[model samples]
Target: MTPPPGWYPDPQAPHLERWWDGAVWTEHLRAPEVPGPPQPAGGVSGRAKAVALTSAAVVLVAAIVTGVAVLGEDDDGGGPATGALPTSVPSTDLPTPTPTRTTSEPPADPDAVPDVVVDELNGITLPLPDGWTPPKNVPEDDVVMTTDDGTYECPAGVGLCRHGLVLTRTVTENDEKSPETLAEQDIPDAADAAYDRDTLDRRLYGGIESHRTVKSGPVAVAGRAGYFVRWRVKTADGPGGYVQSLAFPSSVGSESPVIVRFVFDAGPDGPPLADMDRITKGIRSIGDADTGGGVGSSIGPTG
Candidate 1:
C-alpha cells in the first residue's frame, strides 16, 4: 500500500527532512525545530499566589537580616545590606524576549591529496593529485602529464606560460653531483631563465613590475636530499602567477644516479603549497631501503 506523505527523511542528509508531495520528492526542505525562549511563570491559583507572595517576603526579610548581621560584624561600624535578596515587583510594562532566526554554516570539504605514479624505468614514484590526467609516455626516459582541463592564459603581458598545470618527468644519469650542489647552482639558474622580469613584464602585468623567488629552501624528497623553490609574478591588472620547483637525486650512490625535477605553475589562483608539500612527502624510490625499497644500504655522497 502507498503511504500518504508530507515530509520524509532525506536520503542524502540523514538528519534532515525533505518534502514529499504525496507522489514525488520536492526541493523544499524542513529545518529541524529550534528551542524557543523560556516561558513565563504561570498555573497558580489566587490562594497559592497569595501564599507565594507571602513566602517571598519572608525570604527577602530573612536575607536582609542575615546581611545586617554580616555588616554588624565588620569593625568599621555598619554598612549597607549588600547580600540582601532583591524583591520582584510585578510590572505590566516589562517586555518578553523576542525570538530571532539563526542558522549554522555548513561544514567544509576534506583536503585533497595526489595520486601516486611510478616511473617504471626509474623505479620511482610521485603523487599526481586529483583532477590531474594520468602520466602520458614521453620521449626516452621522460613522462608528461597535466591537470584535467589545466589550461589558462594570462593576458599577453603577464607571464611566459599562459596555462594550467603542466608536470614533466625526465630522468638523466646522475652526474655524481651532490644534491646540494645541484640545487644551489641549477635551481637559481633555472629560475633566472623562467622569470626574466623584463621579458615577463613586457608581455604581462600591464607594465607593472614584480620580482621572482618569493621563497626557496632545502627539502627532502622520496627519502633523499632535495631543494624547493617558489616564484611569484604579480600583474597590475590580474590575479598573478606562482611557480614551485623541486629536484632530488633518485639513487644517491649508484654508479648511474638519476636526477628528478618536478615543477608546478598556478596562474592567478596561486599554488596549493600545503597540498604540494604532502605530495612531496609521498614521493619514494621503488627500491631504496630507507623508503621500503629493495635496495640495501647505499653509500652517502661525498663532497
Candidate 2:
C-alpha cells in the first residue's frame, strides 16, 4: 500500500522506523513527546498487562468451579463460595448400665461338694436357734448373692437366745442414692421398733424390763456393711444385756452400702456377734482367690 502524505517516521522504532508519504519516505516520524504511564514490571509491553488480567480472571473462575464441585460432593456445605446453608448435627446415643442380682445356693455336703471357699461363698456360719429350720435358700432379688445362714431365733419370755446371719450381695449404680440413706430409713425404724417393744412395752407396761442404749455409728462387716444397737431392758432372771449391728457401705455401691446387723438379749453363752466379727475379719474377696469367684475364701466378697 502507498504511504499517505504527512506520515512521519520514528527513529526509536527498532524496525520499520519510517513513515509513509504520498510518494516516498519522510523524516517527520519523530517519537511522540507525550509520556506514557510507567512501564510494566520487567519492562513488559502494555499488551502483557491485558494478558495478565485475563489470566487472573480465568484462574478465579477455575477456583469457583472447583469449589462448586467440592461442595456438591460433600453436600455438607463445607465449601466456601457455594452459598449453601449448614445443617444441625444429630445428638449422640450412649449405652445405659444394667443392673445385676445374686442368690444363695445350699452348701454342698463336704462329701458331695468340696469344703472350700467357693462352696462356702466366702461365708461364715452362725448358730441357728434351737429347732428353727434355716430357709433352704436365700431369696434372690436385688441382692448380689446370698449365703447359707443356718437359722436365727429368740426365746419367748426374753432372756437368752441364738441367731443366724446370712450375707448377700447386690450391685448399685454409681450415681444412685447411697445404701446409708436407704438404711437410715430402715435401721432407725427397726431399732425404734425394738426400743418401743423393749422400753415402752416391757419396762413401762410389762414390768420386766431393764435398760436402754444410745445411738452408735455404722460398723463394718469384714468387706461388708455393719450397724449396731443397745438393749437396756434386763429380764427378772439375771444381770446380763448387750447390743450390736453392722453398718458398713458396700464397695459396689460407691453411693451407698448394704446394711448388715445382728441383735440379741444376752444369753448364758450370749450370741456370738463378737466372735462372728473376729471370723468375718478373716474373709477375702473371691476375685483374689485361686478361683475366678468359683472356689476361694475371703472375708470380702468381690463385686
Candidate 3:
C-alpha cells in the first residue's frame, strides 16, 4: 500500500526526506526530524516541545534554501543566487574626446590708428590721406580709394572718370609669378584699364597714344620687399596721366602677391606724386604691428 501524504526518507537521496502524496513521490523535500521523550500523563513533555520547535526551525530554513535555488534557476539558468541588489550590464568601449587648440596672441585692435581705412578682407590697412576716401560703388573684394573731388566727364567723351584713384587686390590668376615679373606685366594693362579704355570699349582717356616707363625698380612696401613699374601715358586727348603697378607678398595670408594700382591725372588737379611714397609707408597690418621686414625702404633693383 502507498503511504499517506507525509515526509519520508528519499530513496534517491538517502540523506534527505521526500514527500509521499499517497499515489507517488512529490518534489517537496526536507530533513528528517529526530524523535523526542515519551509523553507523561497524557500531557506533552518539555523535551518533546523543544524537539518540535527545533524541527519547525529546520523546516523553515530548508524551505528558504529551496526557494532561493528555484529563483536562481529561473533568473540565470542555474547560476548563483543573488540578493535584492540590482545588477548592471557591462559597458562598451568608448572613443576618447579630442582636445581643442587655443592661441596666445591677443585680438586685433580696430582703433589703433587715426585716419586709417581697414581692408579686413585683404588683412591690411591703408592710411586715408586728406584728399582720398573709400569708394562706395566698388566691389567688396576690391579696395579702392578715390579723390574727394569725385567723378567728372571723361576726356574721351564717354562715361565718367576719376582724376586720382588707387586700387588694391590679390593677384589670384597669375600669382605664381614673381613680384617683379608680375609688376612689369601688370603696368601696361594698368595703363589701359585706367587711361586708355573703359569697360564698354569706349576710349575713356581718348585711348593711350604712347607710354614710357617713369620708374621701374625694387621697393619696400608695408615691410615686404616688392617691385613697382610706373608709366607716363600720353592719351589722344586731355593732359594724359601716370599709372603704376606695385606688387608685393601680403604679410597676412598665404603670403600671396598683392597688387596696388595708382592712376593720377598728370598735373595740378591730380594727387601729388609724393603721396604714393607716403601711402606706401603708412601701410601696415590691421593691428598696427610690423610683421614684414621694413616699411617703404627701397632696395636696389634685383637685375
lDDT for model 3, on a 0 to 1 scale? 0.72
Q: Which of the predicted structures, 2 or 3, would earn the higher lDDT when compared with the native?
A: 3
Number of backbone collisions per candidate, in order? 12, 28, 1
lDDT of 1 by residue, 1-303 (tens): 222455444434423445555545567765333333444588656876676667656654554454345434432323222232123312123256999999999776564333566665555776666655554332212433444544345455443342334343333544544554555455443343333333323544343356476666656665556666666655555555555556666553342334444344444344454555656666677655257323222322221
Better-scoring candidate (TM-score), 1 or 3: 3
Runs off by more than 4 Å, candidate 2: 1-188, 192-211, 214-243, 253-255, 279-286, 289-303
lDDT of model 1, residue 40: 54
TM-score of 3: 0.58
TM-score of model number 2: 0.32
Question: Please, what are the lDDT tens digits per residue for candidate 2 over residues 1-303?
Answer: 332354222222311123434544444433222223566567767686687666656654554455346445432432221222224312223367898898899886664422223213323332333322333443312122122334233334543223333333332434434444544544443443332344324431123354555444443444444443433445444333343333344333232444344333355544444543443343344443321122112323221
What digit string (tens of lDDT, one per residue) describes model 3 on residues 1-303?
Answer: 223466644444434566656655566766666555556787877877887888867765665465445444532533222332124312223368999998898888874435777777567888878888877575323546888787888887777877788888888886365888989888988899888776667897788999998888888777778888888999998989999888887877788888888888987888897777667767777785554456545564332
Between the candidate structures 1 and 2, which one is better when assessed by lDDT?
A: 1
**How much is the lDDT of residue 98 in candidate 2?**
94
